[model samples]
Target: MCGLSADKIQVATGHVEISTITNHYIKTSSTYQKQLLELGNMDSINSLEVNKLKEIIMLQNQEILRLKERLNLENEEQTKNANLNGSKNEFKGVVA
Candidate 1:
């Protein structure tokens, strides 16, 4: 019973963490978009700054995608684990 409760708590925490990450991603994305827009309008913007910003944005996007994929995989694995626990002791049986 406690294990189930703990699992629930862990899942809830993951969801909350993901939500926080998403909000942060949205905020950062908007800020970067504004920066990109400014780059288009400003003739004095440094090329080095533009390149750095582009690098950071690329890295951030990759990190966000990786986190999202991990979250989804965790959710899928947990759900599958729960479904396989009933009336069986063996794990990871072939899915039909």
Candidate 2:
């Protein structure tokens, strides 16, 4: 007895009847226990995969931010250079 009542087990397991859980699941067969263990392992494996994907997405987002910053810096530099050239051209016209 795992301390839970049959009714509780039936509700948790979503079985239609308490007798079904008592007859089918409450008895300990090695194969059933093994399957349960496998299910638990699968849950852990899926969690690990999800964590890995989240890390990858974070890295990608950081890279995108870095590229955007670099692009903005380049654009600012080009604008500054264009303004400098225009001023020089105007000064040359006045002198000539």
Candidate 3:
């Protein structure tokens, strides 16, 4: 019975009617059932892998944003120091 309703079996097997499945396609093989279970397991494994990759990508993006902000702050500080040094040199030149 595969623990499934006749209508569900018919839909999955693409049979026109429940009677067709019960009459002609009712084979109870252990190997076939094992293969089906293995296929289901593969789907779950693939889903977990996909979720892990997405998490890694999100973390990387956050790190990139933090580094960019740090670079901008450093650049601004350098510009301010350069302006201050230029004014000091100009004042010394005028005095001498």
Candidate 4:
């Protein structure tokens, strides 16, 4: 029952793969077979390629977060400096 439930959830997740669809019709040497051939096979990319791509994405995300923190700190400092310079100056002989 657990296996059947798992299959149901798997199917519901919409993981219908291209290979599953391809095999369904390719036995007839259908036009789709030629199309798939032109598009190349999905079996080409290995686990290492996927892992490298994921690592690059993770690195980019970390860099973005670091930059955002730096910008926030700079903005806070600018606001503090602006407040310090924005106050009224002391009255001199020009006072009426």
Candidate 5:
């Protein structure tokens, strides 16, 4: 296990508060011991998971952009149709 102090661990992990890292993140007893033992392995796994999550977020953002563009196009078409219908109604009124 790394012999880092609580403050050092907080700084390294970018934790805003030492208590948060110690109290909430690092549980007590067997789980804590297991985490300490697999710290190096967990670091790699956590990094992989973070990268995967970022990729998923990027894909979701792209999908959202596409959907937004499609919605805008639909709205524009509807507006044009509405305006054309209004013009036809006005023409009929004028002719009568």
Candidate 6:
């Protein structure tokens, strides 16, 4: 299945020898082999999808941080403006 040689299969399966897989685990039937190959392909595809999702999550997290910083700066500016307005009102009252 999947065009891998017996030794390669043995290595992938963590068997010390190819005899274990050939004698017991693998089915020689065409349908079963095809299913195994399909499974291998799906594993590869799922890995790629998982990596892509991780990248998307990282980007969204960065955007959230940026937005939070922007909001914090806006709040600080508003607070400073409010304090300035309060001081001006106090000065006007004192002069009058």
TM-score of each: 0.43, 0.57, 0.54, 0.49, 0.56, 0.56
lDDT of 2 by residue, 11-88 (tens): 788999766887776865778879788777787778888899999999999999999999999999999999999999
What lDDT tens digits, residue by residue, belong to model 6 across residues 57-79?
99999999999999999999999
Best by lDDT: 2
In model 2, where do residues sit more than 4 Å from their true spots? 1-42
Task: Identify the superior model by lDDT, candidate 2 or candidate 4.
Answer: 2
Task: Give the CA lDDT, 0 to 100, for residue 94 in model 4.
Answer: 39
Compared with the true structure, model 1 gives a TM-score of: 0.43
Report the lDDT of model 1 for residue 83: 76
Error of 6 at 84 (Å): 0.4
lDDT of 6 at 20: 77
For model 6 the TM-score comes to 0.56
As a whole number from 0 to 100, the lDDT of residue 60 in candidate 2 is: 100
- lDDT agreement of model 2 with the native: 0.87
| CA RMSD of each candidate after superposition | 23.1, 9.8, 11.1, 9.6, 7.9, 9.8
Q: Write the per-residue lDDT of candidate 3 for residues 1-96, one digit (tens) a residue.
A: 477777878888899976688666665467877878876778777878889999999999999999999999999999999999999999999999
Supply candidate 3's per-residue lDDT for 5: 73
Off by over 4 Å in 1: 1-45, 87-96
Model 2 poorest ten-residue lDDT run:
21-30
lDDT of 2 at 22: 74
Cα TM-score of candidate 4: 0.49
Candidate 5's residue-wise lDDT over 2-96, tens digit each? 56677777877898986777775556567877878877567777988889999999999999999999999999999999999999999999999
Count the clashes in each prediction: 0, 0, 0, 0, 0, 0
